[model samples]
Target chain A: MNDALPPSNQTQHSSDQDKPNTPITPNTRRILLVCRTAPYGNALARESLETALAAGAIGAKVAMLFLDEGVWQLAQHQKPQGIGRKNHSAMLGALPLYDIDTVLVDRDSLSKRCIDLAELGDFTQLIDSLQVKEVIADHDVILSF
Target chain B: MTLHTVNKSPYLSQCLADCLDRVSAGDSIVLIEDGVYGINCATSETLSALNKAIAQLMTLGVQFCALRPDIEARGLQTTSANCPFNLLSDGDFVDLVCEADKVLSWY
Candidate 1:
């Protein structure tokens, strides 16, 4: 069985020192959080939101852009209240308060889903697919969720 | 003139191997999504196999890249934890695009 290997042994990730602290200090470092899914679906989706919120709270200049299927996350008039949830809709509203104001929604995705901005609240911004690559160009860090 | 993107996971094998198999040796592979999970695994034979394939590709001049955020999101910020791969940001991703003749998504 010497040739046999374990299941956990995978590829190599980055070093620990590269990880930032809980309160990421805003330096000249620019970050982009790519939100490609709706909220409350999986851990990654929530984690991406948390990272954006945390980064923004710490005065980090961050942008939250949604593309592909992610456009559904910012839909207007969410009523998860019936599930006895925290009204994620409200929590979503807090993004701007936390300085996570730069929200980008793909225009093509909107047309694909037939989503209307009038339904999504005034906080959301619609962008085209071409602009996304350009936007990613300006950031120092890109976090795709 | 070539971009290095890594598809280190078999899950994306179709996304990459399907469309990317036709790509010449100069193309790159950037591991994102479940791709970054390869960091510091539990000594699984699968990890070893993936690493071997990656090594072969590297020898052939295929670039392998692991997105920074994907690694961090998995709480792999421990650096010395498990998997060791290159890091790239959105700006880096953009620079790659600018460097490459064209960019294709595996998944």
Candidate 2:
């Protein structure tokens, strides 16, 4: 697993440098995207990811938290062969490309599901349930999917 | 006021119920996706419970609405006389989001 620190400095600089003279507005809301469902059973997983990407694209500070059945999204070697849906596992890897580096998975969620930390991708951090509450309190907007 | 969005059906999930419990007076609720199903005024066990909860919340001055596109996609009607929610277009949805102090989306 890659334990490298996120390159947030570069992303923040790039997003801000373009509009140096512009005053910061309330419109630039900090968003936390909470994923509570498993990846394939519904459209929520994909829609949440798209929302995060869209928020990040518009230079909003975006973070994602995985809870409950959402930890299944971090499982390795997923192949939705018969599911007739586009595989979104690779899309998680693309979060950093959109400058969405703060990906979190609940510790209790992973433990309850018997998911190993190694099974998750390198970009995700394992946070406790209390930290999840703090994460929610830290963001200006919360979107659950 | 907060703009709350519920995208899960109340009959299928406890999301709408939980959201209703937490929303303060003057907050706006926008039902989207499968949540538009909660707009049914039909008399059934689940629908009755949902209607009761919505009526109670409305008494507290909370505003309720559903996305027009999602309601149409689900083949559900949201008339002012029967339904507790108003219809919001895509543009109106954006306006509501921007007008609110914060957005809380419940799935």
Candidate 3:
């Protein structure tokens, strides 16, 4: 409720007319997609993965972090057929093909859900909360779903 | 400053609280989608706590806003005197996004 705006000199605005079709620079942006929702119950998990894949496909340096209930997304032996939904766990295997191999999951989240690292397969790297913060700070863009 | 967009009802999810926790001074928060339910200002403990949070953050120069269309769709009443937040149009929302260095969406 501070009606006062930032100093006019400090305000930054990227007017649509400012740069038309800006070229992709050699320094690709580092994007970190964070997933905190369980799969099947909602579209968040699947959408987050799709976003990560899309960013990677567009040549952005993409990384993913699974936290909270999001760790369940990597659980093995998932059979979503009963719900008439395709099992999205298998799609995670295709991440490496998009050059997005740096997928991290919170260790505490997995333990709280009674999941083991082996169950998440070899693609995911189990990380602690402290390391998770480091990964967040390292990224140029952070998208949470 | 970051542009934080909350799209879930505060009563249903911790999205607003989580977004507030991560916001710093001068950051702006826009209640959109179901988040427009938060500005109801009805007689309730949750609304009081939310009002207090908004007032306190305002002291530190944090800006609070709500999407106009969502408010209208939900039939919520807001005015400069009664409401503590600004109501913005879709175009204004886009401008706010351009002004901020980063955007964070909470649902």
Candidate 4:
């Protein structure tokens, strides 16, 4: 295992770092990726995409959830040309191709944002935030971006 | 167990340091919500830098995982490589919290 020590905490030596969070055995490790922002505002959206892509590439059964403003990342009819930017919607359209096709958007966020169910591009699912909570409860890992 | 989570996007320039700060050598990080932003090629000099980072982090003994449903909805889950990436079910999330003594969020 690669070992990189923290600078300030170096002196507070603890064997905690050596402990394995996940064993090499079967079915023990998992992660949940949660996205709550649309692209173009900042790297949060891009980071969410890249991180999910990275996890999937690693052979992990990663789970991703979209909540709050995060649902905007999946909105339909995205045109970045007005902003002179590449369309994130286009990139999002390609996620299923990477084997990461469990996209979920919060139902409330959709209503709050006035996103029509029909507007969602192919490969996206719209579920209530309550369902999202259930989804998180079932995972071995939970992360928010 | 120690979980070294990274919460910033690669393009932001703060995530690298943030990861280095919160995550250690053996801990694992699950990409969540906007925290997934760190991997976009828009800011990556290398198209696979985000993937490379995940690989590199794992090599350091840290496990890296991401949420499946979110990416699936966002249409971004296909970006990752095929490794032992974890997709936690609701029960698993509870176990994660129970399993780890400390949980640090980058947000």
- Model 2, retained fraction of real contacts? 0.45
Best by DockQ: 2
Residues B3-83, candidate 2, lDDT per residue (tens digit)? 889888888887887566556768899999998888764334645666776788788899988899998887877544666
What order do candidates take by DockQ, descending? 2, 3, 4, 1
Please report, in order, the local distance difference test score of every candidate based on alpha carbons: 0.61, 0.80, 0.79, 0.64
Query: Which candidate number maximizes lDDT?
Result: 2
Question: lDDT by residue for model 3 over A37-127, one digit each (tens)?
Answer: 8999899999988888888878888889887778888988999999998888899888998999999888977888898778887888888
Which is the better candidate, 1 or 3, if ranked by lDDT?
Answer: 3
Please give the ranking of all candidate structures by lDDT, highest first, separated by commas.
2, 3, 4, 1
Chain B TM-score for all candidates, comma-separated: 0.65, 0.88, 0.88, 0.65
TM-scores, each model vs. reference: 0.52, 0.54, 0.65, 0.49
lDDT of 4 by residue, A1-145 (tens): 1257675566455554456664643233567787766689988888878888887787677767777667788777788899888788888888887887788777877887897888887788777655764565456666667
- The TM-score ranking, best first, is 3, 2, 1, 4
Screening candidate 2 with a backbone cut-off below 3 angstroms (N, C-alpha, C), the clashing residue pairs are none
Error of 1 at B12 (Å): 8.7
lDDT (10s digit) by residue, model 1, range B7-63: 445543433332233234555666676766654422346545454555555566766
For model 4, the superposed segments whose C-alpha errors exceed 4 Å read: A1-28, B1-107
Q: Model 3 segments beyond 4 Å from truth?
A: A1-27, A42-44, A81-87, A93-97, A106-138, A142-144, B24-26, B40-44, B47-61, B78-84
Residue B72 local lDDT, model 3: 94
Indicate whether candidate 2 or candidate 4 has the larger DockQ. Answer: 2
Question: Under CAPRI classification, how is model 1 graded?
Answer: incorrect
lDDT by residue for model 4 over B1-107, one digit each (tens)? 54444545556544544343334556666666555554343234553545565566667787666566544545664343554367655466566767774454655
